[model samples]
Target: MKNLFFLGEIMSDISVEELAVILEEDDKWLTENYNKLIQQYPGQMVAINDGKVVAVGREVRDYCAARQKAGLVGPLLINVPHPDDLEPFLI
Candidate 1:
C-alpha cells in the first residue's frame, strides 16, 4: 500500500516494510563490524545495500549520488562518527 507523504518530504521509492528490512540489515552489519567502521569511516558517510558496504565518502549526497550513478537503489546511508563523538542530553 502506497501511503501519501507530504510535499517536500524526501521519500524513498521502496515501501516502509522494505525500508525496515534494509535498516535491519544495516543494524546487523553495524553490530558485526562496529569497531571496523569507527576506525575506517569516522565522521564520514557510508552506504550499505543487501547487507554489504556499497559506498564510502565524506558527504552523504556525494556518496549516494555515486551509488546512484552506479545503478544502486534504496541503499541505507549512515554516518559513522568517531567513537568519542558523543552528544549529551540536555533539558
Candidate 2:
C-alpha cells in the first residue's frame, strides 16, 4: 500500500505479497476493485518477476496457455501489422 503507484495505461506496480494477501482475503473484492484502483493510479505496471520463481519465453507461454485451458480470460495480444497492412493500421 505504501509503495503502490500507477505508471501508465493499464499497468501497476505493487508488492506481490500484498496482492497475494488481498487476494486471499477476498478474491471477489480484488476483482471488483481492480479497475477502480487502476483508474485512480493510472499508468502502472505490476511486476510479478521477483523471488525464486522466474518465467521466460516458452514457460510464460505455457503458463498462459494453462490458464486459458482452465477457462481463464487471459490478456489480449495486438497483432503486429506487416508492411502491406500498415495503411490499415495507421488509419
Candidate 3:
C-alpha cells in the first residue's frame, strides 16, 4: 500500500481549485516514480519530497517522525509491496 502525503498543499489558505491542482501534481509525481521506487525499496516504505526520495524504512511511524524532525511537512510516503502483490488502490 502506497500512502501519499502533501505538505504545504494541505494548508487552510488553499482554495478548492488549488487543492485539485496539488493532488494532480502529486499523482503525477507518484506515477513517474512508481517503477523506480518499487525496484529500490521492495517491501518497504519510502519517503519522498519534491520528487526526490528522502528515506526508506520498514516502519511507517518511525520514518514519518524522522521526516517531521527534519522539517519535511508533507512527503510522498509509499509502501512498495511485492510487484505481484500490487495494491488495488494504485490507480
Candidate 4:
C-alpha cells in the first residue's frame, strides 16, 4: 500500500476510488443539511468531518489552521452566505 496526500491529509493504504467515495458522501451530507446549516452558520465558513460540524469561522485560512491543529483529514469546507446577502441568479 502507498501513502496518498489528500486535502492536506495523508491517507495511508487508501485508494483514489475510496477517496472519491468519501468526497461524494460529504457532498450528499452537505446537501441534505444545507438549509439547516444556512440558518445556523449564516455568513460563516464551516468545516465538516465525518458528517459533523468541526471548526467554523469567517476565514478559510483560520479554518485551515484549526483543522490542522485538530488533526482533521479531508474535512469539507463550505461558506454559508447569509440569505439576505444572496443575489438573484438566473440561467
Candidate 2 TM-score, true structure as reference: 0.22
Best first by lDDT, ranked: 4, 3, 1, 2
Q: 1-91 in candidate 2: lDDT tens per residue?
A: 3323212222235465855553454434434555453443233332122221111123334544544454432222111123443357565
Off by over 4 Å in 1: 1-13, 83-91
Colliding pairs, model 2: 6-43, 7-43, 7-44, 8-43, 8-44, 11-44, 11-45, 12-44, 12-45, 12-46
Taking every candidate in turn, the Cα RMSD to the unseen true structure, in Å, is 6.9, 14.8, 4.5, 6.3
Q: Pick the candidate with the highest lDDT.
A: 4
Worst 10 residues of 4 by lDDT: 1-10
Expressed as tens digits, the lDDT of each residue in 1-91 for candidate 1 is 1111121123367787866676677678767986787788888777776777788888767775877687876566777776677445222
Q: Looking at candidate 3, what is the lDDT of residue 72?
A: 68
Off by over 4 Å in 2: 1-22, 45-91
- The sequence of per-residue lDDT tens digits that candidate 4 reaches over residues 1-91 is 0111235455555678987787788778888998888899998888877888888888878788888899876577888878776556422
Task: State each model's CA lDDT, in order.
Answer: 0.67, 0.34, 0.70, 0.75
Candidate 4: global Cα-lDDT?
0.75
Query: Model 4 segments beyond 4 Å from truth?
Result: 1-14, 87-91
TM, every model: 0.68, 0.22, 0.65, 0.77
Off by over 4 Å in 3: 1-21, 84-91
Pairs of residues clashing in candidate 4: none
